[model samples]
Target: MTIRTARDAVTAAALYLKWLGFRDIMQSPERPASGIDLRAPGLVAQVDPTTCPATLRDVECLWLNGLSASAVSVFFSLAGYADDARAGADALGVPLFVMDLTGTPQPVNRPADELVSTGAGA
Candidate 1:
């Protein structure tokens, strides 16, 4: 299914997480007060459904949230990410993925590649 809306993005993200072997996945409200889109055992995820690409602040926020929860963090963006955001994600070891319209998220960085190879255990 084409991900045309935020709700579609959330649904796709949740499904993708499931495919990645993440169990007990929990989705946040359409507009989550915490800005986190999803969560699972040992994981925290942020999905950017906006037209604007995710920025460095976005990446950092995801990292911070995950750190506070003592879980690994991942990011998904429909519009992709800014250069600085990518750099920050790389430095922070936060996995980054580009959420294509097909509802499949493609890895955008090395950490993300590792995540794909290792599944949820990473």
Candidate 2:
């Protein structure tokens, strides 16, 4: 299955976030350079299509944005993340998610810790 609409992916990310107990989820403006794909109080997530495997640079941007906003960082890729991106998230404790073709979100790594905390605590 192929997802043609980025909005659809955003909505799906919102739904998945809702399942994860995020109540203030909303879509961010369409800014390819420096905008979050989705936002919730205390949380910020970016979504990318399967064709676009999220990279470390993407993770870094999200991490910085979240820090500036005083929120936890998250990333969602329909396909997956690069090795460095995974490492970066793990190092920084950013939650990484991958969505299916049907828009169901899957966590790439769920460390047994309670939450994806701030870098200071990570």
Candidate 3:
């Protein structure tokens, strides 16, 4: 589950979600039109494996997409999220995770912390 490239990050994120008990997870195609990287029943996820931190706009887009699907949103980032992004996600109730090189997801905020504690049902 080591994350050395962008593709590896996506794979790792998917595996992590599986470990969290999400079944039948669907990974978005490359250059997904919805900007979502993964989807499962009641869940929507985005993974950003670039050096730049995820931005507020990024989280908002995920949120909007999830809202359209009536699902909860989560984010995984390699370098983590911008300050504004964190604030926005917190207010929107989106869980944010910092993806470690080992592909482990570390909770970045209260919502994420709750998710980690509650796993898939969260």
Per-model TM-score, in order, reads 0.96, 0.83, 0.95
CA lDDT scores, all candidates in order: 0.91, 0.76, 0.90
Give the local distance difference test score of model 2.
Answer: 0.76
RMSD of 2: 4.2
Kindly list the per-residue Cα lDDT of model 1 for residues 3-98, writing each as its tens digit. Answer: 988989988988888899999998876677667989999999988999899999999988999999999899999999999999999999999999
Which candidate number maximizes TM-score? 1
For model 3 the TM-score comes to 0.95
Give the poorly placed runs of model 3, Cα more than 4 Å off.
none
Q: How far in Å is the alpha carbon of 80 misplaced in model 3?
A: 0.9
Candidate 1 lDDT: 0.91
Across 1-122, the per-residue lDDT of candidate 3 in tens digits comes to: 88888888888988988888888899876958777889999888999988999999999999999999998898999999999999999999999999889998889999988888898986
- Across 38-98, the per-residue lDDT of candidate 2 in tens digits comes to 8878888888864868899988999999999998887888879889989988888788878
Relative to the unseen true structure, what is the C-alpha lDDT of residue 18 in candidate 1, on a scale of 0 to 100? Answer: 88
Residue 10 displacement (Å), model 1: 0.9
Clashes of 1: 0
Q: Report how far residue 67 has shifted in candidate 1, in Å.
A: 0.4
